[model samples]
Target: MKEKFALGTALLVASTVPVFGQQYRAGSSDTMDQNNQQDTQRGSCCTSCCDECCPPKDPCAKCAQLWPSCGPDWIITPGAGPCTADGCDFFVTAEFLYWAVRQDHLGFAVTLPEPETTSVGEISHPDWRMELGFKVGIGWLTCIDGWDLYLNYTWLRPRTKNETASSKEGFFLQDYFLFGFFGPPGDFTLDNETAKWKLDFNVLDLEWGRNFYISKCLHLRPHFGLKGTWQEQKYDITANATQPRGSTQFFDTITGSADLKNDYWGIGPRAGLDTAWHFSRCFSVVGEFAITALWGRFDSRAKATQTLFDGSVTPAEETTTTIGTGSFKTEFHSVKPVMEFFLGFRWEDWWCCDEYYTGFDIGWEVQWWGGQNQFAFLPTETRWGDLGFHGLTVRARFQF
Candidate 1:
């Protein structure tokens, strides 16, 4: 009987061994209870050993996590402000865009190439120009709930095409020297040619955007808004051969300085959408495509000229120089389309408190814009050359 009782007790102890080894069941509640009990016992029995034995872990770290600002080594509010798990309430950013641009003049129609000829005049003269440019901008941001809105102002300028000057004789002189038919500047005359002009513009825009978080460290930014853009273009058209003899629209008739300008302004509205992908807490990549439609005018005005000369009486028969101005109300419109890919790094810290935040972004961009100009023959002949422009831009932002 004693042996049989000892055997039964051993069997009961053996059964309880499995339960002790498991520590918890297969359910989440059981697991949580077990973890809590272990944590408590470890804290009570081995305070120093507990920290060394179990390291801290982020319970929620995954792609598409909600609350992107909750990550390791991230500073929420560095300055004097109320601390929050999210981020600073106010922020600013400074960004710059640097790009390599390939562009040309939107000139008149090109006559098909005549059979190969030796004369520069017989060879077609199409205005095909090339240049490079860059732009800079500053912006501010306001966040409410889970949505973020942005307002930015950008200043862009073409570094290469600040100004351009070309005369028919200049080309002739070049050809003559290359072909070994060297001659003086006035010895040759050119006709029906347009002067090289400086083509550039500046843009100001206000946009509202919204971002949604998918994960603790990752989010998606999809936004659409209206942007206001402006432009300024100044160029010259010459009527004289070597100097300003007939008009002063291209150069000074007396000093031989060919510095004439015709200026115009363009204003319009642009509407489009962009998407951004955030990786980690302070790094992101964005892809944007937008269509811009603009309206403005172009007028014909230029510098004054000197009086004409009587060629019949004097040996140097300088004709009386009279200047005439023509004003044409031009409406310029285009489906200005742009594509840009950018990788940005962000520093999310408000300097003086949760009052504001600041950051900087830069990247590459390509643009293709074409529309109708007042120079068109008809009011509706909205066919301008398929012109292309490319460059880079940098910008800064302050968020509130």
Candidate 2:
């Protein structure tokens, strides 16, 4: 009985030792797993904080490295980009404009169909007025450092009208008059007469130039160009007569019409300087001044006609008659000078894109030319005149 009891106790002790050993091994594994999880969480938090606080180096530095000549103090240039080998350095500009033309003198004629005519008397300079005009221009640029080639063209047309009232007693003939049936010069007079005048003026210009940048904010351009100007002047005078006058008998009234025309073409060289003051990255004030020297051709002509009215008939019977018609043409050379100035605001990188720009400008311009000849009624007598124009200009431009 004692041997069986001792064997049973040894078997129980052995079983209990194995169970305790298994619990110790399991606890060691769980502690090791917890330490690893804590370490992983700490590492993740440190990485995120560093990323948020730190900034990377500039990417432009890499560009500088590739192009060492750009230097350390490099700034991105406006208006044009750096030169590249693939030919991306061309640009174009288009503009629409309105100009308010000031009154100008083209030419004046004293008489129509020279040599003194019985149908018409002496005339003086007619009053001229100008209306609003429109213009369009296009420009192209080919860039190479500070040097570039440029071309531009502009056109404008303005309307004018005038009227004058004079009594037949106030009418006079020119001193050089030769042939007239109304006795002597200044002796002929029409009764109750009025005169009307109309004029049209047009101008066109085309130029090509090379640009030289004096600085980042200034430039000088020298150009050679062509200009064309055309003008037409018309006059009409009407008179009421109750009786006959000097060999010619008019039953009722008479109307006289006169037309004068001129054309001028010029070729010349011009030079200008342009400057800008920038108040912001996208806004600027600009000013420009230019002078030109031109060799020009001027052409002039004149014509006249008359119509008789008979109030004795119903609806006032009318008889059309060309009392006298004559044309005089001459070619002469002259010089013209021009000046212009402007101030405006500009918006760059239009539509949030770097390739486009738009701007507005208000300015003034003046142009003058000499050696214009005016045709008179007497072919022997011609008057020399000068041309001048001064005006305010407003323009909107777009560039790409």
Candidate 3:
């Protein structure tokens, strides 16, 4: 009986040892799994903290995301002034110009007397050349909203000269009877003579314009203006005469000079449309078209003088002067049309200030006038003319 009881006790101990070993293995696996879970949670927290401290990769995207309230209409400038806000309140501009003048009626016609009828001989006039000009303007924002007042002045001058010569063996009769005062009306042989022609033109303009803005980039301006123009022309002739010793003529040499002038003044109303299209922050295209109607007066004057030399007279040289004076004037109404177009590149925030800006433009322009009333024709007749220009323009602006 004692042997059987000891064997039973040994069996029970062996069974208990196996059960304890299984429990220990299970507890070790649970501890390892808990440690791995804690490590993963701590790593996730560190990653989130790093993300918050570092800057974003794209700045534009970040700014847009942060300032979603500011729309495209918002203007942000780096300087301070009224210009930094929305639009230019006050401004000034200076323009350099080059233009060509086209006035065909500003020429003179000369005719020689014929046996039966007078025939046209020669035509004389000064050729119009390209001329330089300038303009200056100032503007102010008025009390009326989107309305501005501006004043501008422009000036230009062009000049030309021509020389011609002719000779004849018989009586030289001028179809215009006024030229007969320079010499005797009889037949004579003439040699070596020269004629000179000179002309000068001047133009001035002053205008006051009121602008109504349709938007930030478009506007219509109607204007009232004053215009003045002056033209001066001179013609001179010199000749040497060979006459017989006993000839009955009074003079051996002749010289004549004639001067002509035309002055014009007008007051008018003008209207224009101005437009700008911006394709970038600093570049744009601009265009303008205008028309004006003017009521004006033209005043003309002509004068002539002649000197005659008679070698056969007392002192071997004689000088005589003759004067011809006349006035031809007219009063008329006219219309003028002008067009301008340009492609411009602008630099904003110039001189490190938003109130300062600079721009450059290259383009073409044309102007036409009707009923110009030239001095070359009869007082009752009128003429038309046109002018054109094309070149580069530079502009600097101060906004306040």
Candidate 4:
């Protein structure tokens, strides 16, 4: 009780005391640096903690408190970083994400051209969007050459939706593995079509980095990390066809459905650079670029079913045009590379006499996975598709 009383007394006096010629940060009003000159012998490891509570370089440390987690001696080795006699050894962060994926592979068919129409094979595309997800992380400051270690996880499951398109004549499916399993090229047609898509994305990252100044106005953090991803994609399409057979005076009615799923997980080394151009203590512009080479396995499946309900207009004569049901599953291991980029603006500040830290960042991020859309229907047939993501990200961080 007595110690608390004295500590409160010291703080009240310290805040009001006027100290002259305080050294300012070289570039900005705030550099996350303590209010003192850096030690001459830089990067020297602190062998002990202060017993007397004298500040690392201030008279404030003199009104010291008992160190709960400190070394045998009182003196701490000096460095300019987050971890100071006052505070800043570790941090926690959270982020808000609103993102969407590209719709390249979502389209399955093209509108067939009729006798007098300019329909040059219009592609059917589905719109996919995401509402919200979360990214959370923790970090530890080693205070060794300003190095830090951190880990984070992200999870997002996009909403599923169906998009439909129709034609009076018919729709044509691409001959490649997209629909090659059921019919011959350019012969199969549909009266109406609908497409649906769903995706589950998971990512984990562990990194080691150090933030330091490259120039008066520029700061950078270069990090090397391992990233792991477990991603799954499901796509479905259904089509119906009703055409009159002039040769037989009957109607050829066909209905079919196709489903494809690509599930994979990979882990590999990732490296990146985080750059910050500080316009002032409270605001900065930031950008990042990272690449990872992932070694992973892909378990893919493709199945299709088609049925014929052929009948005459008069119901006097009838013939059924039936199509078969086919399915195939395969799993393989391969290596692929992913590249991601981001740019944003940041606002940060400290309160409570700089004992704690808080920051906010808003930005845009993009990611591309090479050959992520691996779809196959037969042992010999394979289709490679690239997956990409673009989104808005907002981050909030607190440190002590």
Predictions in order: lDDT: 0.40, 0.46, 0.47, 0.69
Clashes of 1: 43
Model 1: residues with Cα > 4 Å off, grouped in runs: 1-88, 99-143, 159-188, 191-194, 215-218, 242-280, 293-358, 372-383, 386-388, 396-400
Better of 3 and 4 by TM-score: 4
Q: Model 4, range 266-285, lDDT digits (tens) per residue?
A: 99999999887766545679
Q: Please provide the root mean square deviation of candidate 3 (C-alpha atoms, Å).
A: 18.9
Candidate 1: global Cα-lDDT? 0.40
Candidate 3 clashing pairs, residues 3+ apart or interchain? none
Tens-digit lDDT track of model 1 for 220-289: 5555555555554443333222344354343322211122332344455555555445453334465566
lDDT of 2 by residue, 281-333 (tens): 34446666656666676666555444455444445454454444445665566
TM-score per candidate, chains pooled: 0.51, 0.57, 0.56, 0.72
CA error at residue 114 for candidate 3, angstroms: 13
Clashes of each: 43, 6, 0, 9
Candidate 3 structure quality by residue, lDDT tens digits, 134-154: 777776654443345566666
